[model samples]
Target: MPGPVSLAEQVKEVWTSDEGSMAKDTASNRWPKIVQGMVDDVAETAATAVDRPQQEEALSIQAALKEIKDDMLQNRVLRPLPSDGRDDIDGYNERLEQLGGKCTWLACPWLFGECYLYRRVQTIFALTHHWRDYDIFKRQKDSTFAKSCKAVEELSARYMQVIANSTLPGDATNEEARKLLFVEMTEVALWGNATDLSLLSNLSLDQIQSLQGREAIAKSQRNIVDNDTDAVWQYLSSPLRFNRRIDIVLDNAGFEFFTDVIYAAYLLESGLASVIVFHVKDFPWFVSDVIAADVESLFQHLESASIFPNRSFIDQVVPRLRAHFDSGAMSIKQHSFWTTAYSFHQMKALAPGLFKSLQVSSMVIFKGDLNYRKLTKDGLWPHTTPFKDAIGSMGAESGIKVLALRTNKSDTCVGVESQERVDALNEEAPHGVWIRNGKYAVVSFSDGEKTDGK
Candidate 1:
């Protein structure tokens, strides 16, 4: 067999080439807009700064934002991060130094550079006195959620019905029904990934609605080229159901997050999980990845009849969701490790606290393409590499159970049964177009049981 494909090799592919693909678009288009958005926010907020020192701080942030934008457009080398007391900053700076102190915008490893961009943007706020709590992406995140009202209403109604019909745990008579609902809910979460802001930047209201709901999911079932929902259900329904905590490392907010919450609600209500922990990013990341604030924002939106335009649906769902939050059946958490350059494979060595936290959970679900990429080290694995092998250290028996629900939006993937399936997919759409489009998906699971003592 050939040696593992390195990030150096992967970067030369069309996916990361400066010509096209989301990576190119992100570097060329999204990064400038992101910096400009922050500049605008700084300007807007400066008007309200009460003191001269605060006004000066806001001005400094604006200056930094301009520099950030210029650096991206010019493809300038990534600069070292100033000390921010966060543990991850040193790690980022270390990586920057290791990359010859000159990793350019369009040429660096896509995953690392993308993460670095967010971290660099965040450093501006960290250094500020008056703007530490400001979220530059808040307007976009809120607007996107507001636009997703239709899909939110539809999923809310469906979720309520599923909860109503779900059987209590250990009900042998309803086993098949519960399993079926598991598949449905997992698919709902999977397809929710189709609308990430970083990639599908121009999705209209109709386009978003078309990607959601039961009918859309039914129509797109054939697109799930690699599914392990049965394995997921089997794990959840296992006999060793004592310490049942389900941890979700979240992805994009708005509709996707809305779906994930309902899925967690179902798991709690149906007794599949005793508690649910949502792991969110500590800062604005990948434009739309959830932060802890988004959970409350989602609930606030759901509770507003004016925003959702479905009083009955909101009434049915909001209270139960609130109950979960109130009773601590559901909780949201964040850690610096989530936004760091290190992948999940390095979690144990780099972020042991987080790894230890996950080790105790019954199941940990990694959502969307980025997490899947990080889980697999963002390397181009042979198409037939087992999901467990692709994940490296995280797949060891001593590690935590992991389930990846991802829509294929990147080149890296594993755990398909055969290479022939990949060939057929390529024949359908040559030159790897089939994988980059969000139409295809994978529901991959790893038992996290060590076969050999590594």
Candidate 2:
């Protein structure tokens, strides 16, 4: 029998950056900070434990988290993941082994290394009896969500109005109005990605306001580096789109997810999609990535009187949102494939079930920077590469219509129409800011329009 293909041969190089990009900074800095957060959370929780065993469990996890941080600080070799009985473990271990088991925290591929850090953290808790179901990042996710009261309240009011207006005669019946609303709601979901806790560990309320405030929405629309919302709107508005299902590969848990839920409601209200399905991680991941439980937490926050201080808005919105899930018009599915380190190109092969499942949806929207990175195999393509080409087989003609609503927060950028524009942005702005900073975004869509590789 033949052996597995090498990682080098997988996609040229799973490129790791030491400078000029987010990965460099992430490896050297952000990662240690993330682990430190875990250590601190576990330590604090351990102090107030209910029993000696539980306290001991928390203490052990905290010590393990400290070791992971130390490994990064020391640039120690990447270790194969210990068995946790999860199916994705083999894939991660195989990749680590393929690197000769010698790749270090800072020296290895950035995407893989970053993902491994999260997976490593999960195993520490996964193997423990008391800490098995714990999410160390929950406090941060909840804290950030609380800070987003401004955007949350605004969106609740907007959602209530949209739901009300949607029922009126001739409201949004015109093509222009529908498309206009599409841009508005899509940008809401897009900019909400800016408050990502994994990247901005110390995100402030002012910073969160700057990213998600209603007043800034129109001005920030210009920062979408590659605007493909028109294409997504075109496809979703097509005659064939009637009664079709839409899927969102969800991103963050707090305010970003609130916008996603709002967007899902917009889809059903506008008659663009009959059903909305959310794909969430099975376990805690990447700091703020939505696990299945966060969906309920989001709704609880929405319904919280203290959080909003405006019962009228959430009262108008929350019940209808809950009704969709109850009525099967909207659903959430957790697949282990999402939590895996494998790039999306490997999906069809490594995660055949997920690939087939996604193929049936009218459109599969991959959310946030990490999903975008996995879709593009972590910045492997040139700036001028077409969105379809950059995503490999998941592109057009794969029977999966992909609408990537990503705020560029890393170096791996593709689908920008002009190299000259990229050059001008780089020259005019601070170094790598256009790509690494969450200020810019891309609304990339792919269908059978381009026939290069697919």
Which 10-residue span in candidate 2 carries the lowest summed lDDT?
A: 197-206
lDDT of 1 by residue, 403-422 (tens): 99998887776777788988
Error of 1 at 210 (Å): 25
| Tens-digit lDDT string for candidate 2 (1-454) | 9898733245443444455657777888888898898888888888888789999888788788889999989989988889998888898999988889989987888888888888988889899998899988899999999888876767777666555444334434345544555666787777776543222112122322343432443455677878888778777777652579989999999989988988898889877789999999988899999998898898888878888886777787889889989999999998888888888988999889989988888888889999999998885566777888778778867878888888878887888778898898788666778887777889888773446632
The pairs that clash in candidate 2 are 379-412
Q: How many backbone clashes does candidate 2 have?
A: 1
Off by over 4 Å in 1: 1-22, 45-56, 168-173, 194-219, 451-454
Give the alpha-carbon lDDT of every model: 0.78, 0.79
Clashing pairs in 1: 397-449, 397-450
Candidate closest to the true structure, highest TM-score: 2
Q: Please give each candidate's TM-score.
A: 0.87, 0.90
